[model samples]
Target: MLELNDISYMAGNRTILQGISFNVRKGELLMVSGPSGSGKSTLLRIIGDQLSPASGSIRLNGRSILEYRPEEYRQKVSYVFQTPTLFMDTVIEDLEFPYRIRSAAPDMERIRELLPEVGLTEEILQKESRVISGGEKQRVALLRSLLIAPDILLLDEVTASLDRENARMIENTVKCLSARGMTIIWVTHDPDQLELSDRVLRIRDGKVVESIA
Candidate 1:
């Protein structure tokens, strides 16, 4: 479980999040829904430990995330952005990048199986990541993030750039993962995403106004 207590953030003179508090249960899909600039992305970043809250405590699994080693904590909690960012040239390289970073053995067979599950064919594995469509890249990014089997997944408008077909493909994979008990926290303005969530949090000016669970 992840818990945020009286979390607040400030940038220069402006306050972004004010006493934000929430608890995300294990295996629950928590959807943060609100207009742009409502601090959804910031909240995710805070939870992911990319950004620190000015005042508050963020606890993961009954302990503060700050107490864990950075790499170990990151492996347990993965964050995916709106756009697919790849470091390597090819699709396969990008998928295998995480394990490489951690010096872990590459599970080739598992990766190959995941590729098809994410709607990518074997032929495209050798191709440059830049050549793939935005949707394919996003799927690849997601696979890369899941290489270490993160306990918590934080996604920011993951399907915002994909077409309906591609979006659904990603959605299906996400739903399948959620069904298998992954902790998914996503930020979106899409009603469909809200409808699919186990819990919905509505934000206004960085404060949670209502929770539809």
Candidate 2:
């Protein structure tokens, strides 16, 4: 469903990514692992179109990503950062923001069903977003992303800040999504996360060194 061909990126004299190439098939969970400064997140940003590759190209469904409208492309391929950002005062308002932007009604029932999967209750939605724990906030951010129904999810260390239990909940939720056929490209340092991946790619100094399937 997604392809990266000879992708490379640089920052001044430093190289961040070099000739990185990989393909993520539909419904596959691909885990990207590397040491700090190895450019895993940069790779994801390129795929999400938040950053353009210095050389090479990214394609989705056989079409160049540059060919799609920015907003339309992002709706089909969403990116969730390591830290959750909720600008709204209330959880419901935050959850409803996406729908509000699209001029569509919020799907309260679906939202309610999604809460428990991430270890949250519907009552929490009525509370202030600022009062929620980091884990809860991350879950909320995740749910908000999923609500948009993106075909591919680009996750950048999303569970890095959460406690073990909360991380497990997020992991389970991601696995469930993959089972339901959502293509996932997850960047994680946790070894436990590797167990859930359909394939694992390791990078060193901006180049793919090993790929385990």
Candidate 3:
């Protein structure tokens, strides 16, 4: 469903990625694990269109990624950063953003169901973003985007902050969503996280080294 061909990127004088190519089918969970500075997250950033590649072609559903409107493309393919970003005063405001942008009413019942899946309760929504613990903040940030349910999710070390139990809970939750047809590209350094992947791709020095199915 998504394709990348000979993707290459350079940061000033240094090469961040070189000749990377891979394709992920619909509803696939692709686990990326690699050493620091090996460009795992950089690959996701480029795929998410947050960074322009020096040379490459990316296609989604047989159309060039560049052909789609930026907002529209991002809506279908969302990227969650390693660090959470919640600028709003309350968590509810942040969760309401997807509905606000689409001019659609939110399914609060659906949202409330998702809360406990990520180890959060509905009452936490009224709390200030400043008062939440770091893990709570991250979960809320991740949950905010899940309210809209992007077709493809790009997660960058997303569950790393949580303890193993919570991390596994989050992994299982996302895996369940993936089984229901959401494609996921996850970058994680933790070996235990690889358990849920449909396929695992290991990269070193900006190139694929090991691939397991």
Candidate 4:
């Protein structure tokens, strides 16, 4: 399980997160909901190790997240942003990113299997990322994040910008991944998406006020 204990993050005089705590069990889908500036995304960033908390600690299993190697820690827990950022020009380029980052060879067969799962055809591999719809790009980003077999996924409003069909596609993908034992921590304001969660946490002023299971 991924555990957060009394986690507090401060920016100069302002405290962004205060005594924030939770546990994300293996294969569980945890949805964090809040209004803007409630620090949902910031919490995700802390889990992803993008930001450091002023106090407290985060542990995956029994180990401290801060003790792991930077690259290896990132490989173990992947973060997917709300906005898609494609590195290479083509769809294949985006798909091949994680492998490049880890200096691993691209798995063509795995990539082929993932395309249809994300509602993309094999032909999409050849298309330029710049030409694809925003929804398609979001799926591409998701598949890319999973390429490295991350044990945990941190998503920040990942489906917020997609249409109904695309949003459903992404939600289904997340469900499948969690079913297969990938821990998920997602931040969103949509109640519909929260319906898919195993647990729901309501955040206010950077603190968890309610936890519904």
Candidate 2 minimal-lDDT segment of 10 residues? 113-122
Q: Model 2, residue 120: what's the lDDT?
A: 85
Would you list the clashing residue pairs of candidate 3?
A: none
lDDT of 4 by residue, 27-102 (tens): 9999999889988999999999999999999998789997899998999999999999998999998898788877
TM-score of 2: 0.97
Clashing residue pairs in candidate 1 are none
Task: Give the Cα error of residue 161 in candidate 3, in Å.
Answer: 2.6
Q: Where does candidate 3 have its weakest 10-residue lDDT segment?
A: 161-170
lDDT of 1: 0.90
Model 3 C-alpha lDDT versus the unseen true structure: 0.87
Count steric clashes of candidate 4.
0
Q: Provide the clashing-pair count of each candidate structure.
A: 0, 0, 0, 0
TM-score of 3: 0.94
Q: Flag regions of model 2 displaced more than 4 Å.
A: none
lDDT of each: 0.90, 0.92, 0.87, 0.90
lDDT of 3 by residue, 1-213 (tens): 999999999999999999999999999999999999999999999999999999989999999999999988998898888788887888887887788788988778878988987779989989988888777877787788777778898999987777776677678778777788889999999998898899999999998888899
What does the lDDT read for residue 199 in candidate 2? 99
> Candidate 1, residues 1-213: lDDT per residue as tens digits?
999999999999999999999999999999999888989999999999899999999999999988999998999999999998988999888878888887877888888878876777888889998898899889888988887889999999999988999989988888888999999999987788787789999999989999998
